[model samples]
Target: MTSAAAVASPATVRPSRGLAVFWIVAGLFGVATSFLLYLEYVGQLTGADPIVSCSFSPIVTCGPNLLSPGGNLLGFSNSIIGVVLFWGPVYAGVSSLAAPGGMRRWYWRVYSLFIAGAFLFVHFLAYRSVFEYGSLCPWCMTVWLATIPLFWFTVSWTLREGVWGTGAGTRRVGAAVYSWALLLTVLDYAVIAIAAQLRLDVIGSLF
Candidate 1:
């Protein structure tokens, strides 16, 4: 019984640590991204272009991006959403470390689902900003980039916890789903980067 318990303990403890690390890294990046967005938001409110003030210059302008229709998703600024979504995960990750037994499995599962929903929403907004708005908010893109790791790590952690299931069939299907999501995200970013580059080139050529 002692040996059996020891084996099971490793499985639970090791994965939890790994998941905690994932959330910590994601939270740190999210916090940094939020700070940048806050600066830009402050600049917009005060009638100054923060990106230009920061020396990003002609190629990147937070002002235009913030003013775009996509920036006000559902009538609220995107940074506001980032603040709510990111701070929760950051708090959760930190609290887990300090508390006894850390966070529970169900807590992680529910939190992961919440973050997943946010990720989907943000991805949609990102697509609109890139394809329809025709501008990239550097701060917004940073949030998007940070969100990827948050989503990926959460999903990975959930899988390792066997929250979905432990059967071979379940594992196979889960792996496939994760792989497809990752592939789609990569393809989407690649297309957006290529399109943005082309747009910039065209504008440059005209001048």
Candidate 2:
């Protein structure tokens, strides 16, 4: 009979440097962008024009978005929210890296859910930015882009590892998703861009 250690598969292993790097980049970008928005919010209150490099055009403006009511949904800047939430992935990534044995499956499962929520939130913000306001915050877009792969990888990895008590069938499905997650991420960006291009003349408005 096969021993327990011999039966164990490499697919059941935890996250690697690739997944960690994805989170690190996502968290760092989110923090940076949110901080910039905070600066923009400060400038708004001060009646000073924020000198942001991403302030490219009327359609690609961060100032107006920061000054809008949406910027302060809970009596505070959403950038504050970004600052707080964005640190999660960074902590997860760093901790996973630091631990010699790597993080637990349940921990990764929870982290996956956290990133999934972030993915949804970012999409909502994207909708508001393009359709509602007809403006795009370049920094916010960066967070959105980072979140795509971060969410995809976490959840897919969780499922592949059977963290949710998944069996072989589910593991196979998860493995497939993990394999194609990057391609799906690129397509996601494409679909969002197409939607934006259809709704707003993003290119035309730029020039």
Residue range 1-207, candidate 1, lDDT tens digits: 001001133223223444455567777788778777867777887876565353253545566667666776658677776776687777766765566444555666788798889788777876676566666667777787778756765665456445555667665654554546556567666765677667654246324
lDDT of 2 at 203: 90
Residue runs of model 1 more than 4 Å from their true location after superposition? 1-14, 49-59, 99-102, 173-191, 198-207
lDDT of 2 at 196: 85
Write candidate 2's Cα lDDT for 1-207 as tens digits.
Answer: 011111124333446766776677778988888887787778768877776766788888677677677666788888898888889999987886676566566576778888889888878878887778888877677767778878777777777767776599887777788888888899889988988888987898889
Clashes of each: 0, 0
Task: Give the top-scoring candidate (TM-score).
Answer: 2
Stretches of candidate 2 off by over 4 Å are 1-13
Q: Weakest 10 consecutive residues, lDDT, candidate 1?
A: 1-10
Query: Which window of 10 residues has the lowest lDDT sum in candidate 2?
Result: 1-10
Please give the distance, in angstroms, between residue 13's alpha carbon in candidate 1 and its true position after superposition: 7.9
Best by lDDT: 2
TM value for model 1: 0.73
**Candidate-wise lDDT, in order:** 0.62, 0.75
